[model samples]
Each structure stands twice: as C-alpha cells, then as structure tokens.
Target: MKSLVALAVGALVAGGIAFAAPASAGCQAGWTPWGGGEICDGPVGSDGNFERCQTTGVLGFGGTQCFIANVGNAQPPRVGP
Candidate 1:
C-alpha cells in the first residue's frame, strides 16, 4: 500500500511538470515583435515554399495565422516598361 501511494505521488509530480511546460511558437528564426503579437518565418512547406506566420493574443490564448506564397508566381518589376 505504501508503494502504491508513492507511485501515485510520483505520477502527479511528473504530470505537473509536463503540464507546466512552456509552449513554443515554432518559428525557425527571425521573431519580430508586433502590435500585441509577433511575426516570424515558419517552416517550409511541402511545395518548397516558405510560410509567413503571425501570432496574436496574450500567451497564445488567441491564435496563429500562417500565409504561404509561391515565389515563382511573382513577376519581376517591368523595368521601366
């Protein structure tokens, strides 16, 4: 019975540690502070394009939005056409 109580206490301690772990924004690098939020570059996509992400709200209580754009689709400036 003593062993059972010890095991339960240990489990609770481990669970508390896991629960207290801080969450990450998953930004590879280049984190910039913005108005009440932050913006950063996200991981590359399967299409070989990069993703731009913005996170808002306090302590991640709000949400994060990601936008993906294809660099190949953009046309260079007309060069004084």
Candidate 2:
C-alpha cells in the first residue's frame, strides 16, 4: 500500500513537469515578433506545442501574414470520433 501511494505521487509530479510551459526563449529561430505574436518563414517549432492562430490575414500591403502563439495548458483540439 505504501509503495502504491509513492508511485501515484511520482506519476503526478512527472505529469505536471511534462505539461509545464517551456522557458520563453523568445520566438523560435527565424521567427520574428509582430503585433504581440510571431511570424515565421514557415511553421514554428513544436517545442512548446506552439500553434498558429486561425486568423491569417494581410498586414496592409505587406502581403499575407500568420501568427503563432503558445497554447499553455489548454487541451488540444479533439479529432474524429
């Protein structure tokens, strides 16, 4: 019984660490800051589960632009049942 309790506690600690936010190393390499978000030449790194916002749009005459933002501890979107 004692061993089982220890195992449960250990699992919880490990899980919490795994889901913790990554240290902000600023935007990923090659990604630049823009309007409080990031703009990358391509897809941003998945190191911190970074996601591109769904609101892609043009910035005046600067052509198309997209933004990437961290999703913190929020659950990922569900897929097909």
Candidate 3:
C-alpha cells in the first residue's frame, strides 16, 4: 500500500512538472514571449503590419489557438509636401 501511494504521488508530481514546463520554456526561434503565450511578427500586408499570436494550455491539452492581426504601419505621416 505504501509503495502504491508513493507511485501515485510520483506520477502526480511528474504530471504537474510536465504540465508546468511549457509555461517557462522559451518561445521558438523568432517568437517572443507574451502573456502566458508567444507571439511574433507576421508578414506585412497591403493593409498594414501584422502580428501573430499563439496560445496554449497546460501540456497543450486544450485551449490552443493561433491568430494574426494587423497593427498598422509604423511610418509617420508626411507633411509640408
């Protein structure tokens, strides 16, 4: 019984560690860390600049989504033409 309990505890601890690992792991190359997720600059488009976001839940078991958005161009407006 004691061995069984120890085994269960060990499993739980291992699982917890695995689940928490990604939260601290560095983002992939070119990606930057964001609030509990990672993001990176996306390709510029005719409309504007873009940013991509990727989110994942613990152990990637659920609540994973990816999206891109336009953040507008960064150039200042011309004056005194």
User: Which candidate, 2 or 3, would have the higher lDDT against the true structure?
Assistant: 3
Comparing 1 and 3 on lDDT, the stronger one: 1
Ten-residue stretch with the least lDDT total in model 2: 28-37
lDDT-based ranking: 1, 3, 2
Off by over 4 Å in 1: 1-35, 43-49, 58-61, 70-81
lDDT of 3 by residue, 1-81 (tens): 656544544444334433342333222211112212332344556776454534333222323344555555321111011
Provide the lDDT at 30 for model 2: 18
Maximum-lDDT candidate: 1
After TM-score superposition, the amount by which residue 29's alpha carbon in candidate 1 deviates from its true location, in angstroms, is 12
Compute each candidate's TM-score over C-alphas.
0.30, 0.25, 0.31
Candidate 3 has its poorest 10 consecutive residues by lDDT at 72-81
Cα RMSD of all models vs. native, in order, equals 17.3, 18.5, 14.9
Give Cα-based local distance difference scores for all models.
0.40, 0.32, 0.35
> Order the candidates by TM-score, highest first — what do you get?
3, 1, 2
